[model samples]
Target: MIAGLTWLVGFQLLGELVVRVLDLPVPGPVVGMLLLFAYLRLRRYDDSGSIVIAGSGLLRHLQLFFIPAGVGVVAFASVLGRDVLPVTVAVLGSWFLGLVVVGWTAVGLERLLGRPRDDLGDPPAEAAA
Candidate 1:
């Protein structure tokens, strides 16, 4: 577990270093995750690998990671309240846009792949009834 955690942190640090040096616009953690994914793909580690075990352990307690974000929101409550209208509009607008884009993409992919929508298995018994 320690080794796995170390590897994870090491990759993150390496990512940070690369980003800083290259003046990247992306977050360091995102780059680190991509690097880790590439490494895993090339190395082909099994489920029992230390990295996988550590990652699973972290995922099991994923909710704990949200604490900081919650605290930040509370700290910025006043600011958020002042900009609530814009924030709400931005959030809802983005959500609607994403939904439309994803729906269109799914339909496009389905057509491109020659997969008919009706071929999706039978509906639930309750729905059929």
Candidate 2:
């Protein structure tokens, strides 16, 4: 358990480093989790490796991970109840708007770069042939 906690902290720091350097939009800890997940997936283990066995314990007690969050929910019940809809709307609306902006930016970028949008157009390189 102590080792796992240390590992988590180290990974989190590593994530912050990458996020800061890359200027990623997502949170650092989220990037760390993605890095850890990618590492776990890439690990080559022997057939008799115990990684699976070790992971089973964490999976079994996954609900325990949410205990602190549950406590927060209880402690803030009144505040949550009072502003739930506003909070939900703000978060959801921001996420939707972000998606829209990102989509539009991508389309604008593709057009600016002159990438062919469809098969109906001859390849730009071939047009000079």
Report the number of the highest-lDDT candidate: 1
* Candidate 2 lDDT by residue in tens digits, 10-125: 77899999999999998988898888778767886343444445445577998999898899977877877778899999999999999999978987898999973665566788
- lDDT scores for all predictions? 0.91, 0.78
RMSD (Cα, Å) of candidate 2?
10.4
TM-score of 1: 0.79
Q: Give the TM-scores of the predictions, in the order they appear.
A: 0.79, 0.44
**C-alpha positional error of residue 27 in candidate 2 after TM-score superposition, expressed in Å:** 3.7
User: Model 1: which ten-residue window has the lowest total lDDT?
Assistant: 115-124
